[model samples]
Each structure stands twice: as C-alpha cells, then as structure tokens.
Target: MQFAIENALPMLERTPQVIETMLYGLADEWIYSNEGGDTWTPVDIVAHLIHGEKTDWIPRTQVIMGEGSKTFVPFDMEGHHAVKKGKTMSQLLDEFKILRKENLAQLKTIDITEESLNRTGIHPILGTVTLRHLLAAWVVHDLTHIHQLSRVMAKQYYDAVGPWVQFMGVLGGKR
Candidate 1:
C-alpha cells in the first residue's frame, strides 16, 4: 500500500476509540467468550493490543528510523498475556485506551519524512523491513483485530444463524 503519514495517523489515533466503541461496558460473557475453544477472547485481543502499543509500533519505528539496518528485537506474539491476568476486561480496554493515547502522542512528535520512512531494519523472521512497511502494518494490525472481534462476536450467533452459516464465512471459518 501507499506509505503516507496522512493515511496511517488517523488509524493510529482512532484505534482506542474504535476498540471502545466495539467493547466498552460489554459483559464478561461477551468479552471472554469465543467460538468453542482454543481461540482469543476480546479480552485477550485487548491485552495483545496493549502489549503492541508498548512494544511494537513506536519503539520499532524509532529503531528503524534511527538505527537503520540493525537487527530488530523479535516480537513475542503469544507472550505478554501475563499483564492481563487478574484484570477485568473493562480494565483491559481502559488500559489499552491510555496506552494507545500515549503512543499516538509520541508518534506525532517524531519526524516521519519520506527518507525516514524508507529507512530499513533487519527482521528476525520477515527479513529486512522499512518504516513505511511498519506504519502500514500498524494500520492493518488494528483492522485485523477489529475483524477478529467481529468474528468472535458473530460466533456467539453461530447457531442462531443456522442455515446462513454456509453464507457467513466468518462463522464458518477457523479464524
């Protein structure tokens, strides 16, 4: 996709609000429920988001822009959940809001010029990547979790939508 700060900033700015709109004040059943078993709950997704706000986006942006071609730290996807333990889902969402707000504030203070955006960093798995790629991925990452939240919620209606399961790919797929 095109690499423009114009495109990415709004998403970075609005993620917490979108998340709140999707999950604020939801009951524990909705927040913790998932399709059958062995999947992420909305609560888990929020914790993952909180972890990303702290560890992924701006920190990596700084590395790629400032350290150029340096091998970056690998992100621990399955880890970071310990932060969520003992917290209610509402607490998780509120914490994400604060963290995301702080990150967006930090992101705005940085100088993300075309040159900076073109700067590259070595990835442990995906090989070399650029700041442009990271920014784009950040937006897509938010979208992915939003879709995941929707799918998880939709699954609560899986049986209600009986025959439509064939048509509703979200309820049918192993997301």
Candidate 2:
C-alpha cells in the first residue's frame, strides 16, 4: 500500500502502548535477557526506540521541511546504552510514550500535504531522501523493533519448548 499520513499515524501513535503492553510488568529475564551475542534485550529495544523518538523522526522531518540544515545529523545508534544504564524499563517506556505523543502532536501542527511529503533532505549517508520516505521509515522502524521484541521474548522459551523447536522459527530453527 502507498504511504499515507492518515494510515501511518495510527500505527505510530499506538506503538508505545503496544510496546508497553507487551513488556510492562514482565519478569526481568524477559525484559533484560537477550538472544545472546550482541543482540538487544527488550530493555535495549525500548531505549533505542526512545532514542529514535528524541533524535530521528521529527528532527529529520524538520530538516526536510526546511526548518533547519538541509543535511541531517548523523544518528548515534549506540547512544542509548548510556541512557539505559540508570533507568528501569518502566521509566524508558514512559519516556517513549510521552515523546511519541508530543511528536505526533507536533506532526499534526505541520502543514503536511502530498506535495509537501515530496520535500527532500540529505541523509548523512544515504544522500537525499523525501519526507514520505522518512515517514514510511519511521513506521517501519517501529515495526522492526516490535518484531525484534517478540522474537527475543519468544526465545526465552527456546530451550523449554523441547521438540516443538522445529516448528518455531524464532528460536533460530531449534538450535
């Protein structure tokens, strides 16, 4: 389907609530453990999402909208590790919710249109990108993490699932 602001907002707006619902009040093992070897735990994913909210989406949109420099600031992918150190998952989720709400509200205030969505900005690595591409990416980025969160959480039961492992794609094909 084509990207449309009307369709994108529901997914963007509901992402935090979906994340919070899936993760909040879970055991630490589910919240903090990873798929091993540098993969993110749910906590890390939440922090990364929070970081993207504060840095990537609307900020880049502003640049595309001609509100600031045409060239985008290079995003710090690992910057959230430091921010996550002292905070609990609950705190991170709350921060994400608030930031997303604010960003979506700010988005509503912008005079975005089909024509405007074609406006371009220079990505640090990818060269020129349109506003529509950025917005579509923002939605997909949220989805990618959400899928990662589910896969990571499911792997917590990887070994416990026993012979059913062959049926489970998330456990790396049953180890």
lDDT string for model 1 (46-144, tens) is 999998888888888888867454777888887657868999877887889899888888888888888888888887899989988888999999999
Clashing pairs in 1: none
Candidate 2 structure quality by residue, lDDT tens digits, 74-105 = 99999789768899989999999999999999
Q: All candidates' lDDT scores?
A: 0.85, 0.92
Error of 1 at 119 (Å): 0.1
Candidate 2 structure, TM-score to reference: 0.95
**Highest lDDT model number:** 2
**Model 1 residue 48 lDDT score:** 91
Model 2 lDDT at residue 136: 97
Q: What is the C-alpha RMSD of each candidate to the true structure, in Å?
A: 2.4, 1.8
